[model samples]
Target: MQYSQKVLDHFMHPHNVGKLENPDAEATEGSPACGDQVSIFMKVDENTHKIQDVKFLSYGCASNIATASIITDMAKGKTIEEAKKITWKEAAEELDGLPPVKMHCSVLAVDTLRKAIKDYEIKHGLAEEDKFSTDKIIEELKKVIYPNVGEDIVSLKMVKYVGFKDGTAIVDVEIPKFDKYRDNVAEEIREHLEKFKEIKDIKITM
Candidate 1:
C-alpha cells in the first residue's frame, strides 16, 4: 500500500525513536491472534503529572508502527490528563487517514499507549477512586436498551476488563468472532472513557 506523505514521514525518520533511560512507565501489547505487537515507554514528571518523553517499539505492519510513533510525538510534553483525550480520529487525521483495513493498526497504537499509562499508574499506586470511572459508562449503556442483552453493559458483562494509567482508560471486551455487536460494544467503551479529560487512551480487546 502506498502511504501518504505524513505517514511516510513518520514511518521513515520517526521522531522519539529511542527508549528513555529511566522511564516512569513501560507497557507491551499485541494480538497473537492477529500477529501484531507494540511496546511503549514513557517518562513522566511526578510533580506536574506531565509526560517528559515517550517512545515505542512495535512489531507490526507499517501503519501500526507509524501510528505508534505518531502517538509518542503528540503525547510528549502534555500533562497525563491532556494526553488521555487525544483521539484515534485525531491520529488518523494527522496521518492523512489510513485505509479502512489499516484503521485497526491505528486503534492498536492508541490502545498500546493506554496500556502503558495503566502501567505508570500501577507503579505510582494511584488511588482506586481515581480509577474505575465506570459509573457514567454504565449509565450510558442503560439507554441502549438491548433486546436480550439487558439494560447496562456492566450487567451484560460486556466490559470484560477496566483499568487506568495516568488518566488513560484500558478496557477489554472479548466479543464472539463475527458478532454484529462488536463495533457497538467497542464504541460504547470509547465514548465512556472519553468523558475524562485525563483519559488519553482507551483499549478494547476482543
Candidate 2:
C-alpha cells in the first residue's frame, strides 16, 4: 500500500506521543489481540473546558501510531466539546487520507480521544454514564470497519441482525465466504462488543 507523504512523516516522527502526568482524564481503546490499541491522556482547563494538554500511547502498526499522534495534536488545545466532534473520517483526511485497510487506525485514535473526553465529563459531573442496551451494541457495531471498503459494516449493510439476551450478545453478518477480511471483521466486532460488561458471551454468525 502506498502511504501519503504526510502519513509517512507522522509515522516516522509522531507528535505528542507519551502519557501525561496527572491527567484529568484518560481512556484506552482497542485490543492488542486484534493488533491495535490506543490510550489517551488529557489535562483539561476546568473553567474553559479546554484540553490543556493531550498525549497518547499506541500499540500496533505505523498507521496506529501515526493516527494516535495526529489525534493528540488535533485535540491538544480544543475544548472537550470541540474534541468530541473529531471523527475518524476527519482524522484520516487530516493525514491526507489513509488506505482503506488502514482506516480503522484513525477510528481507534478518534475513539480513544472521545473516550478520554467522556471520562473527563463523567469525572467532573458534566455528563452521566449512558445505560447500556441492545441499541448501544448496534451503535458500537457501527465502529467496526469493513477493511475492504473502509466503511462501517452497519453503513455497508453487512450486518444482518443484532440481538442480546440474558448475558449473551448475538450478531449476524453477511460476508462472502472467500472474503479475505471476514475473520478480521468478526474479531473487530468481538473487540467492540466485549467492552460492555453486560455481555458475558458473544455469538457471531456469518
Q: Pick the candidate with the highest TM-score.
A: 2
TM-score of each: 0.62, 0.97
- For lDDT, the strongest prediction is 2
lDDT of 1 by residue, 1-206 (tens): 56788888888877777677778988776645445777889999999889998988878888877898899888889987788787666777889977655665666677678767777877887633244455544443332322233234555566676666676666666568787766765665565456567667776677
Candidate 1 segments exceeding 4 Å error: 127-206
C-alpha lDDT of candidate 2 relative to the true structure: 0.93
For model 1, what is the alpha-carbon lDDT of residue 178? 83
The true-structure Cα RMSD of candidate 2 reads 0.9
Which pairs in model 1 have colliding backbones? 84-199, 84-200, 85-200, 117-165, 118-165
Query: How many clashing residue pairs, candidate 1?
Result: 5
Clashes of each: 5, 0
Residue 176 in candidate 2, Cα distance off native in Å: 0.5
> Tens digit of lDDT per residue, candidate 2, span 1-206?
88889899999999998888999999999877878989999999999999999988989899999899888988889999999999999999999999999998998999899999999999999999989888999989989999998999999999999999999999999999999999999999999999999999999999
Task: Candidate 2: list runs displaced more than 4 Å.
Answer: none
